[model samples]
Target: MKFRRKKSGYAVIEILLAAAVFVTIGTSIVYLLIDSGYSNLQGRDRVLAANFAQSGLEATRNIRDSGFDKLTIGNHGLALQNGSWAFSGESDIDQSGRFSRQIQISAISADRLLVTSNVNRIAGISRPLNITFSTYLNNWNKTTLLPPSWNTPQIVGIGSTGETTGNRNPFGIFVLGNYAYLVADQPSSTGSEFFIFDISNPQTPTLTGKVLTGKRVYSVFVSGNYAFLTTQAQGSTRPELVVVDISNPATPTIVSRTSFNGNNYAKDIVVVGNYAYITTLNSNSREFIIVNVTDPVHPVTTPVGSLELGSNVNALNINGNYAYLATANDSGEIRIINISNPAVPTLVKTYNNPGLADATEVLFSNDKLFLSTLTNSGTNPNFVILSLNPSDLSIAVIGQTQLAGNINGIALDEAGNQVFTATSLSSQEFVLLDITNQAAPVIKSSLNLIGAAVAINYNGSYAFMAVNDLIQQLFIIGQGQ
Candidate 1:
């Protein structure tokens, strides 16, 4: 017991062996942790690559949906322009710059295309990491337009009238699909300012629904499931832009109203995608207003500042990224404002009416402005065509026509060879003219109405007219010989 003698060589060797085993276990754990971390990183990279590849394919599909002509046979990157997808560059990189994506479009047929999306790691730890997807796209854009018809116009149906007061004057008329929406100044018997009619049967446009939007609804522009309207401001703080949900033709609901504080009231409105460009009767203050209607329920105003037009704006039309304004300015009856940069709208050009008359209604087609002016010299070219010079953005009046009464509303056929306009005259208020020869357009047909046709629209086959008459507020015109 006293002699804890010198340990055996085997015991010393056993101790060293135990230490070696512990060291080996510790080293194994360290390597395991490192490998686990690298595995997680690789998994994350693969997920991101897959997501990027999927996005590339989706964007290509969007381009095809918009216009198949854009999908050419080449590798392309994507750029979002005016809330639309467009091809740009050769390849696109991820936000972190760690990955690159390319969309390859190949022509499969005249109406069909092959899209191949490829994504790969371009930076950081890369030992061959790639993701790919492919899809076929078809032109689905084969649209058969409404056939051309210059037949005599007929008042096929009469719907929407006031049950209480004398008359609810119709201010705006829009025909979309099988429905025609009319916004009026005075509320009808149902205390409604918005009326919806079923035009599937143009012969008998049945009054389908009505929404009471107070009074003095001045203008309306329908898009998809909603109708954008401009109303006379009830109070200085009252919103002038009203959004109505017409998802249900039998029952329309007023979802939202936006006020950009443009002027006394919103005079006209034009919606392009998610934004709504509005003008007011403010000659002294900011008249051009922009509203972000992306969220149709809760619209945000002044997102892209406002512009002072220096004149009372009567009507507004947006084509591409430009906004055409019909103003009361004697010198600048037509104001062409560039809206490509929505944040700051600049006046590109202005045109004076032939008789220096104020513009009442305006439309643009093929770089030409189809305009109607206020009362000038009796029958002194109230309606004129203003041509635009692309290089310098200059304006020129090429052709003109006149009516006994002021032309209040205008419409154009699909081919752009025919134009339909309504006047304040009690008789021959609806007139159609052939514009094949731009220098001098000839009237094709004219129809007499019960009262002054204040608002009018054409849909290839039939012409719709909204008159100021009390008995027949809506006159559905049909094609006749």
Candidate 2:
């Protein structure tokens, strides 16, 4: 104690520095809170505006329910007339005076009317927000066949069913008319893993209904009144194939679920007729499972057989008696399965090349087969076009070209002349490749995105993409974009 060193200024300096750091961190946290508060306020209003637009549409529906003549072609406002909903002025302002709503009606035919509802945030708000909902109304009593298909939006990812931020991300999407069914990649504690949306408009999709299913869903295929989901088994009790009844898009319920014998991840699914073909991640165990879905309510049968592909199958496409699987095998990139016998599926052939290895998506259109693959840094073919002989199912590569990054998904127009792809590139993830001339393909158009585009759907005029971003999970890519 007597030999203790003199007090050093360094200790005091260190204490002062520590105090400064604490102050800085506290100040940063305070600023972040303030900024987030403002952001949430704007976000909450957008949700409200979406609800407002939906209300306007439903009100029109109510009017239609009363009488078809009420849906006259014109821009009309909504009001309560004689205790019944009716069209009024050009636009209606909310009581809060924060939003304005307008309805536009047009005749598609004598029995059908295209109804659009538009909502916008009024003045006084720092940021402007607008929402739109469009749907085709039909005189159901007068129709004999199924209702005509609905309008396809240019860009749609997520929209209003009062959706909130949660531990979820977009994984699968299927569009039916103005409706889009979305499946998330993670389980929601709130039990909303499956979601349905109204995509009659762009950018802002409308949420209609949602339900809970698997702990992790990889892909979704909608056929008839059922939504077939490829989900990962959380445990022995959890299932790999979960089927939900979406007869009423507003309310979906899980009717049946099936689990495989081995531990695996169910990746992609494609429903054809009475069979639901699902692929799993690469392993010794079954990588391809075929379940008889004739009875969607009770889909799985005892001893449901599966095939081992030995390689990872990222995606699958069905054509007639064949199932094309895009795989990541060194010896074979595309595995053609003869599904003529669903219970006993056999591998027909495997296609692979020097530069093309990890195949991600396979698309069949006309007499052509398109493959989107992950590429290397240099010249590695990623977009491949092949000529297929449907009779014999022979494959011959017509041409291929190197792309910047891994191609996540591909969709073709009705004409099959243009090809659309979502890539993993941070920028230019959405690309349009001209395959009009199969011998040579060139990039026609591309839209820069901040994150990777995971999945995509196209209806000639519009491309609905499910991106990897939480804030903008789904969006529209107009033909013009």
Candidate 3:
């Protein structure tokens, strides 16, 4: 009558099953909590690493701004001691001790420094993470003007215009007939952004017309009754090629606009016949893009027409069936591309010389190539003249010369037998060279200006120079004896 003792207790197997279920659930919850905490920590570390890397870069810039002599080649860490900034030749970290920072200063030239900042962190969950930032710092304040002996040139009518502050930097210039077009940035102002000046009187350039592009223009090229302009790339606004009809320059209108993809930035352009050859920098590579502009109102880019180069292309020139490019980086190279077939451009040859590490501008005149280069780490020629054998793509160095500063722009007057160069670092901003003796070129005159000479264009009697100083924006240099 006991009913088998009512199975007084559940079977041992049942109790064991219940306990196993509870253990499994508890273990899963604990593991998930641990994983979430680890993920949060890893993300925090990454952000901290990035911040430290940026701080290192700023510190290096501060050192550079303080004095060029303060920078030296090697690993360095910024330390604040005695209410002053100092550089220590040791790897240092923040208060957390989890992030370490260091900097490397490499001398690219006498006045140029390539700074690299690095931050490292190790969290044990993965391999060490390293973040880096790099930039070139030039001694913009250093003025190394050598007194012009006897034949030094002089600037006659130097004038200043435009906004002195707030992103109103004048950058590009193009002269056609009696008018000169200037592209500048007017970020804080209204109205037209591009300006037209009546340079018919070089001594007094009067502003006659202006047109708005709604973006910062970096370059301008004129042909027929139209003007083609390239703008700087910003956040959501990609770099573009804009066509403006200037049949009546007083009232210019935008006709066509073309946008580029994948971090493409337009630096300079040259037009030949019905095609426009543009040199651009795409992320870390250089590209040559050819656009058919026969229809000015509807410019079309050639299909699969971009050719990649070794490094950034600074300046380009087109002659006959060839395009010469000045590609630069730690080293410089001159690339010749055959563009006889606009749709299919081909690289013909490349030339590299010891003194050609910083080729900034290139010009072709009468089978001779004028390459404006910068000296390397040591003493080398900053300007080079080469003879181009079109049939074989062979180049021979005819003459080489060194200047007190880096040459940023070059222009030639074939009829006058002169070469005008705009320099950045020298005491003289404008240099007039007599290339009449191709093999033994002589400097006719050098003039010191108020600002760094960035771009120059010669039109028979006068040289229009784009000056990048806070005050003076442009200078009209007349030929002086």
Best by lDDT: 1
Instruction: Report the lDDT of model 2 for residue 194.
Output: 74
Residues 1-481, model 2: lDDT tens digits = 4787867788999999999999999999999998777766776777678788989988999999999987888998888888989998999988888999999999888988889999999964578888887766888778565432222213324442233544456777776777777777663455566778777776567777887773767888999888888886733677888888888877888898877666778899998887888888866777887888889888765435578888888899999888899998877888889888777889988888556458889988788888888864467688888888878878898988778888888888737567888888776888888777878888876776646887888866567777775444666776430
lDDT (CA) per prediction:
0.80, 0.78, 0.74
Which run of 10 residues does model 3 get worst, by summed lDDT? 157-166
Worst 10 residues of 2 by lDDT: 147-156
lDDT of 3 by residue, 110-175 (tens): 887888788888444465677775666778676465553325454555444444334555777777
Residue 23, model 1: lDDT of: 99
Which residue segments of model 1 deviate by more than 4 Å?
1-151, 188-190, 234-236, 414-416
For model 3, the stretches where C-alpha displacement exceeds 4 angstroms are 1-152, 158-161, 185-193, 234-239, 284-286, 301-304, 329-332
| Root-mean-square deviation of candidate 2 | 9.8
- The Cα RMSD of model 3 versus the native structure comes to 15.4
Cα lDDT tens digits for candidate 1, 346-367: 8888877767677888898888
Where model 2 places Cα greater than 4 Å from the true spot, the runs are 1-166, 202-204, 414-416
Return the candidate ranking by TM-score, descending.
2, 1, 3
lDDT for predicted candidate 2 compared with the true structure: 0.78
